[model samples]
Target: MASQQTVFMNHGQGETSYARNSSIQNADQERMKPMIEAAIAELCTANNGLSRGNIVIADLGCSSGPNALTLVSFAVEAIHKHYLELQQPPPELCVLLNDLPDNDFNTVVKNLTTLRRSDEPVVVTGVTPGSFYERLFTAESLHLACSSNSLHWLSKAPEDLTRNQIPAYDIDEHARRERLPLVVEAYANQFKKDFTLFLKLRAKESVPGGKIVVSLLGRRSEGISSKFPRLVEILLQILSVTASEGVFEKKKLNSFYVPVYEPSDEELREIIQEEGSFWINEMCVHGLTSGMDSALITPNRLANQMRAVFEPLVAQHLGDVMDEFVRTAEQRWSLEGSLQDEVARLATVAVSLTKA
Candidate 1:
């Protein structure tokens, strides 16, 4: 597996920048508000009468954008509401916004200071730049940790996938679907390893009885025919067209891989149990429809949304051809049939766990 070094969100302000195209992710984060509240409440209650003076919370893979600060705001407000319900003074908050080193931490903090609610407890936000697969905090320092739409990212691409010049989710290109079981297994096993290490690290950093909430894009189906993977197929076709043109080397696409895997519900449960650091308190899969409305699914918007996420990775490999590739994707999407009458459902798995 190739270790990921710069898997951060798109930066700056533009139509394709993460700031503008992250509505889907923001909606997903909003969907996690209740889960965050519940987790914080559990953390507060588990402390009994202990003062808990300073509450430590980490938002792992906290990308830089509006949605990132929105997550912090939700957590702060959740903790405030919990303290209010308990008729206790709110504890000082120590929030660690974590992501890859390439993330725009300055923008994250600036946005945090802007979006922070005045009524929320005093929060001292810090930037933790590193991979979540590694330990970032001291032992027993954290009270609650939450991640949204992030855990699906693997620490590295599967070695076999890279070796075979197969992108992680490109199961439909070049007769790759015929090798579905092997490819999916490789991705799943990689996720299991990364997620297991994640659990173990968080377990050590978290105080006994601490809480963690994680929400990730995943699949209910065991096969590669899911909507997300199918979407990647469309993207692959678009890339293939770009490759057909002399714009870039065709072999580059073969070598490029996105270090991400969307696991199934059963796979997640199995890994959590195998990790054995935390007990699952609540686990559920939620469906998300793009902001194009349940009745309207425009591919242009969807493609741009996907592009915003993947442009950084693609640019790293494709370099100057990145713009042409994105344009080709947009054109391909614009020619697609109207899906307005269809309701496209995407799965997101939310799990809340407590330290054992």
Candidate 2:
């Protein structure tokens, strides 16, 4: 995994860019729209309208892509609708789209210009470049906060797992899976620390009763059930099988690990409660399909999606071996039969919370 300062989404509109291959994430965000609206409405109604007669909205992990701007649009429309319901004029809007410093802000700004409405004035928008794990805003300076499809990324890969022979993502191998008890525990502990700090920072930045709507990749079962684990398992199996045929070195494969973690619904609830700064308003898990509903699920689309996301992480670790890794994995899938017949599902949890 890359350092915190360098962690970022694949950029530009090329084949591997997050902008081109974020359909699954976009679908998840679409499913989260109602929750976003409801949270905004809840915030507006409770404060005798827009709290300070101005609205400050921030997207904490607003990566460089359509989804980042899409989130901004959702928040803007939701807040606009709230004012309409109150029969009051809308407040001045301050929008903050945040991501790590390495993110392609130029791409984000270009996309924003193409999507802007001519009738509406340019928003007071700021591009915030930093890890969301730290403070970025002044105290009580924000009213609504929104983030989607981002929190699953940890502050850093688990230090314990990186030093070991078994990569953190190899959940399918029985021997490795057995040894993962401690590794899983370490990931969970890191998540707790990161999330606790996230809550603390947000509490300090938001006014009392301010609302935050977050939709992140998570699991429905307390046990590991999400396709993320299985996806990496398939990749690991491919590498192992190909290495036996002298396609690559087994040593190289064992050392690479992607720094990501998915939480179950129960885990998220517990963390929110334990953090003690926010009151949970809504927390639910939704199972999302990665491909078309009527067609059979194939490796082509899934592999492409994985490439868009994991390419950076894999490249950062494996360096020159990244190409071989991708090729062998795709070749293995081609030889095998169907991985999924119809539906390939992933679980995501969306939570709406109020600072208290």
How do the predictions measure up, each by TM-score? 0.88, 0.87
The numbered model that scores best in lDDT is: 1
Candidate 2 overall lDDT versus native: 0.72
Best by TM-score: 1
**In terms of TM-score, how similar is model 1 to the real structure?**
0.88
| Per-model RMSD to reference | 3.1, 3.3
Model 2 / residue 250 / CA error / Å: 2.2
lDDT of 1 by residue, 262-340 (tens): 7777878999998899999888776655332543345556667778887888778777665776677666655445333
| Per-residue accuracy of model 2 over 16-111 as CA lDDT, tens digit each | 788877777787788778878887777777763365577788888878778887776888888777777877777777888889888889988777
lDDT, model 1: 0.75
Candidate 2 local Cα displacement, residue 355, angstroms = 0.7
For every model shown, the clashing-pair count is 0, 0
